[model samples]
Target: MAQVEMNRSVQTRPWFRQITPAQWQALLASSLGWMLDAMDVMLYSMVLVYLMSDLHMDKSMGGFLATLTLLSSALGGLIFGILADKFGRTRSLMISIIVYSVFTALCGFSQTVTQLAILRTFLGLGMGGEWVAGAALITESWPAEHRGKAMGIVQGSWAIGYALAAVVSGLLIPLFGWRGVFFFGIVPALVTFLIRKGTKEPEIWEARKNTRSDTEKEGSVIKIFDRKVVRWTILGSALSICAQFGYWGLFTWIPSYLATSVSQGGAGLSIVKQTGWIVIMQVGAWLGYVAFGLLADKIGRKATFILFFGLAAILVPFYGFTHDATRLLLLGPLVAFFGSGYFSGFGAVLAELFPTSIRATGQGFCYNFGRALAATAPFIVGTLAKSMGLGAAFSITAISFGIAAILVILFLPETKGRELT
Candidate 1:
């Protein structure tokens, strides 16, 4: 009777408190992988000015490099999504860490713009692949009722990684220069050891693998395009495209915009000051990720997504137009919060959309292919900024965000609390 009562009590507790050790390990591994991925990837953006000067490149070239990375990341996502399905999420995640980490460190040795570009492209593969495995792992590990919160926490680690990059750039750029910062990216490679020790593949995936016949394994990729799932794939990709466009366009240039002179249509802050502001802004993003998850669990996924997307559309233009130091500081957090919070919903909704057979593959293709299309954002913004200024270039993200909101309202189904198993 005591044991039964204790089990009942545990079940009644809040989701965080009720999480098993295995669930916590999965969450931790996924969060660390994503955080390190952001740190490794964003180091380039954080030191873009240095790269431009050192490599004797122009803004278009700098933007093109970012674009190249995103395109490669898209390909990586597709390949690794299939890998995660076939091998295991943990194994796929481990391999991706090594791929991005070694390449990122190699970037420090690049002597020419061409070499840097090639290295960055390789780095992107790991960057893009990490999310598919991490998201699928989190979805399978956590309970259905609390999956949104789990996704939110993992997504929120992105802010932490971005903040770390800013801090590393601020401290190291003056001391060791951009090359040293790139070298530091090799640190994430060590994280694979922890993941290998602490994490295991979800039982759901194992059971599916054990029971599957040879014939059933065929056409895994093609299944995403089957008649029943095709609509969700289309709509999900559309939504992801809009979100990625807004994100990559804005963030890829934000560090440069903040550091540029006011006469050049930026806030004209110092490097250290810009880093501080970005870190503070990410605090809001972290909050937004968490709040969005809780709200998603309560109000439903589509509603929460619509809310964040619509607000982001409003906030993007406002943030872009402001050059006043005080106003820019104030608006930065709001922009980050609204602009980024909706991402948490994607992991949950996408996982719920597909079955265990191809969950990673389906979600990976939708998100990364959309990312591929959105890869144009940085180059377009750079070209536009050369003419109109960075502020005006940012206003375009508002349109993307607006369209994303509409896409969710018109087509996507609510997936809150949907059991993946």
Candidate 2:
């Protein structure tokens, strides 16, 4: 009977209770940082129509601005990856929060598209840095067996942030205009205090720092390309390129597509209705992120990663071609689920691919450099929309999704339960 009770207890044990208090703090801080970072970043997309109308910007111009932010963010990711390896993750994270917050708010005060463009460029720097620091922090803090689940929770918070941005836009845009929505970007800066008070650098990073040789101390970006790591780096970047292309190409224009009149080949949703639909869609995204992590931990990263991409490939086209309003509403969550969930695997697989010495630098480059390459996605989609309409242009993401699944099958190896050495 005692043995039976022991087995039952083990079966029923909550995953959270298995980690130490310090791990919990790391998870919480990273989740909040990622969540707030997403909220601030996505606010630009949420209010894209208002900005274009007020600033007299066309789709190409708007897409160019988004592209610029992404290019700068790629640079930021590379810089912060080295910083996270050299400085403590907590310190790097704190500074990044301040940088993006201040710039995001400044975007509100811009009278011209050029001004908003300049501010958004600066905001991209911190937006890129936060992920490098936060991903490293969580990967190092958690045990290998549970890392996928931990990263899943962190990535899942992105959906929550998106939903929050939708809610904020819905409520405040009516009262205070798009500027009011941007002003709330400053609220995330306050989260630095909680991070400062609650979090500590991962002990693994501290130990690695203490034992580092002169060359290793620099956390040189070139080290990521050493023969041992170069293959995974290239493969990782390819995967990132496909994923980012599919995501930005589709999402950047989804709001505009929804709000445009049916005569104009859109859903003709009011801003409020579109916002509500977006919020509901994020529920699917949140579930996708969490489920991807759990499934990755169980079945191995390669298989689970491919699964999401495969489903996304099919769903994106279906969602795009469907003209029925009710069908689109019902399809939103399913598309979001398969489209966005695979992100949960990225942190784990990338973190696993490199040693502790250059994990941040390697993963950062693979992810962000790919981001730079994929930066063309929005512009391409926008340019295509001018000719083919948003639905047809948006459906192009399905091809990108299919490519991602194929890449995973051909190149990415199983990295399940890989310890971050």
Q: Which candidate has the highest TM-score of all?
A: 1
Q: Give model 1's TM-score versus the native structure.
A: 0.97
- Positional deviation of 221 in candidate 1, in angstroms? 1.2
**Per-residue lDDT tens digits of candidate 1, residues 1-421?**
9999998998888767999899999999999999999999999999998899989988898999999999999989988999999999999999999999999999999999999989999999999899999998999989888999999999999999999999999999999999999999999999999999989899899898899998886227899998988887888789889999999999999999898899999999998899999998888888888889999999999899999999999988988888987888899899999898898988899999998998999889999999999999999999899998898899888999999999988988888778885
Q: What is the lDDT of residue 301 in candidate 2?
A: 94
Give the count of colliding residue pairs in each prediction.
Answer: 0, 0
Question: Model 1: how far is 129 from its true place, Å?
Answer: 0.7
> Mind giving the per-residue lDDT tens digits that candidate 2 earns over 1-421?
9999986786577877778999999999999999999899889888988988999988888788888888888888888999998888899899888999999999989999878989999999999899888998999999888999999999999999988988888899999999999999999999999999989999999998888877545557888889999998999999999998998888878877887778777788998888988988899999999999999989999899889999999999888877677888999999989899998888889999989888888878988998899888889888887787778888888999999999999989888877778
**TM-score (C-alpha) between model 2 and the true structure:** 0.96
The CA-based lDDT of model 1 is what? 0.92
Which parts of model 1 are misplaced by more than 4 Å? 1-8
Worst 10 residues of 1 by lDDT: 212-221
